[model samples]
Target: MPDWLSLYYEQPIELTHGEGRHVWDAEGNRYLDFFGGILTTMTAHALPEVTKAIGEQAGRILHTSTLYLSRPMVELAERIAGLSGIPDARVFFTTSGTEANDTALLLATQYRRSNQVLAMRNSYHGRSFSSVGITGNSAWSPTSLSPVQTLYVHGGVRGRGPYAHLGDAEYIAACVADLEDMLGQTAGGVAALIAEPVQGVGGFTMPPDGLYAAFREVLDRHGILWISDEVQTGWGRTGEHFWGWQAHAGNGPPDLLTFAKGIGNGMSVGGVVARAEVMNCLTAHSVSTFGGSPVTMTAALANLTHLLEHDLQGNARRVGGLLAERLRAVTAGLGLVREVRGRGLMIGVELVRPGTDEPSPEAAGLVLEAARERGLLIGRGGTGGVALRIAPPLSLTVAEAEEGAELLGQALHAAQDHMTGRRS
Candidate 1:
């Protein structure tokens, strides 16, 4: 593993197995999993539906590539197309979100005949070379070399930018103005503007509801495709909508969208959906070997079936609402907690220097370690790792939600006391 690869705690605990919302470590200690392996375990850990599908499919056949017809792949694609609102949408499977975004970038650039792209400030698309070029967060983007020239636009985050202090109406107006000005400065046409409806890796922060709808107008005028990176926000994780893009529904659907990380329930599965015209823009032949494997497709089909049949979206709304409220109430009086933000099952708690807006990355690290000690596992992210990311399995029960919140409260108090004593 790379030295830069992060472990959850100071003493990393290896997980042995999990069921529902709980997992056991190698030491036989159990934990209430709150991050769901960075939101990859969408439905639950070791869900029988998904395990059965994989078992049944493996018993039949395994390594047939895209050269042959695949019923599971075709069926999964059909269901995804219906869910994706792109007009005459075409689905192309990939193995990860990085590949999905890479494909989306390819489609947009070829369709528009331009390599220049617009991306939101503080947004994270993926880790691949092509995807990293458009990433707005300098922390996550490791290199300056790129295949495309990217213009970072405003509105992914509205809490600490040039337009942070403005009211909602004013913030929207300012971001839209910034977009217009940025477009005017471009010497050539842009291929597309890719954005995450809710900025996921950037502390799970969200812009005003209509920010993207407003940006969509400008992109349309310039013939720039709109690509929504729904890797972290899709599959009804946001609770209020099926897809994150629906939050900006006033602009209708995006021209292209990419998804991954959750649909296969720990199995690697990802793909891109685009309008038929854009998707078919590739004149050259292309194929992904492990992308639409029968095993993965079967798992995805079963997982999607489980999600819809149980209406986990509704569960996310009800349980996530309770969790968020409980979190806010527990941390309200703590000066170290800056804010509790995000929607539904996906949430971020930002930490700061007590009484100031300055980020406290150290405080976040302490809290993360403290949470692990309490047998609670969460995630840390943001430009400086100053936010605690909370995204548990959608199948989390009401009791589990309350228990996790209580554990988190204890963790926060412990973090606060430690930080204070160290300062003194």
Candidate 2:
């Protein structure tokens, strides 16, 4: 490591190799990988097809501009459009979830012809300038809330889509009203409402049932598009959902659906599925080259084939439910746990102080470290960074998931013991 290079967070142990859910540290210690590359490695580590595809593709063509076009790229786009469960949708490839967010945001702006967006307070979209502006977080960089100021708090409306803009979901409406007021008095027009269908990085938060239905009605009335950021929740990772939006009640679909992670199965690929009407705004626009290489798209195509062939989406639901139930049962006695939330495998264990009611972030870190040392690897999340992110590969076995949960229980108890020893 360079001397001037700042450690982003905790120092990560060097792993020599990984296969399935197990990882071997440089020192030869084995760890069960509950993190699963932040929920990207859906097929698990060192997946056979992924390795073969990479080796074969790397040996072949690597890059070619979209202008020239490529078979694999076009084929993969067709696959995405077809599997995206959207009719007459178009696909635009990108390099990461951030760029996907950027693409969706751009499309939303064009769709509503407005300057505002609506997002939830606990939402986590991405870290780009515009995405961050709509991303509701205090520490999400200074640019997180800088784009529209008061107006950014509201949503856009150009055509019919999802919306209620009232009651509990009313904040989205308040945002809409704010945008309407701002547009009437100032700049005018609201662009879109972008959010994670299931807030993966934001503590695996899930909205109420039928929420999207009401939201859709509202957006339709306002003419603002619904952009679902499925970077972490897409594919079979969330079990029953092929698309994250389906988990919530909604009619029809999102104007733009963003994807990364599972679609690439850890490959550096991301993109957006846009409704033809919304995507039409880009026809006259010039391409600045965000498209993926032939090799990357080939890998994505292979991954998609694998996902459907194995029916991994259904597996995600079955195994994830089994594991979450086990963990929730074991953690039920803990005083430091606030709640265990989220659907499928994208679970979160929110931490709070036992008695004082303040979150015990240090305690959560201790548990995570203890779990790592005891042959399991888990990560943290949430606003205070105290969430135990227990998402594993969608392909993880029921036995493996149970084993991971058991180890996490042991680690939590061990952390509690350490605190007791210190207090005594």
**Candidate 2 lDDT over residue span 254-355, tens digit each:** 878999877777788889999788887864655535477777787888878887899888888898899889888878877777777777888888777664
The models' CA-based lDDT, in order, is 0.92, 0.74
Residues 1-424, candidate 1, lDDT per residue (tens digit)? 9998867777888899999999999999999999998899999999999999999999999869898999999999999999998879999999999999999999999999999999988889999999999998888999989999999988988678788899998999999999999999998999999999988888898899988899989888989999999999999999999899999878799999999999988989999999999999999998889999999999999999999999999999899999999999999899889889888899899998776788999889989988988999999888788999999999889999999999999999998898888888
C-alpha positional error of residue 322 in candidate 1 after TM-score superposition, expressed in Å: 0.7
Instruction: Show model 2 residue runs off by greater than 4 Å.
Output: 1-11, 144-187, 283-285, 288-290, 420-424
Which structure among the candidates has the greatest lDDT?
1
How displaced is residue 99 in candidate 1, in Å?
Answer: 0.7
What is candidate 1's local distance difference test score?
Answer: 0.92
The TM-score obtained by model 2 is: 0.88
Total clashing residue pairs per candidate? 0, 23
What would the TM-score be for candidate 1 when compared with the true structure? 0.99
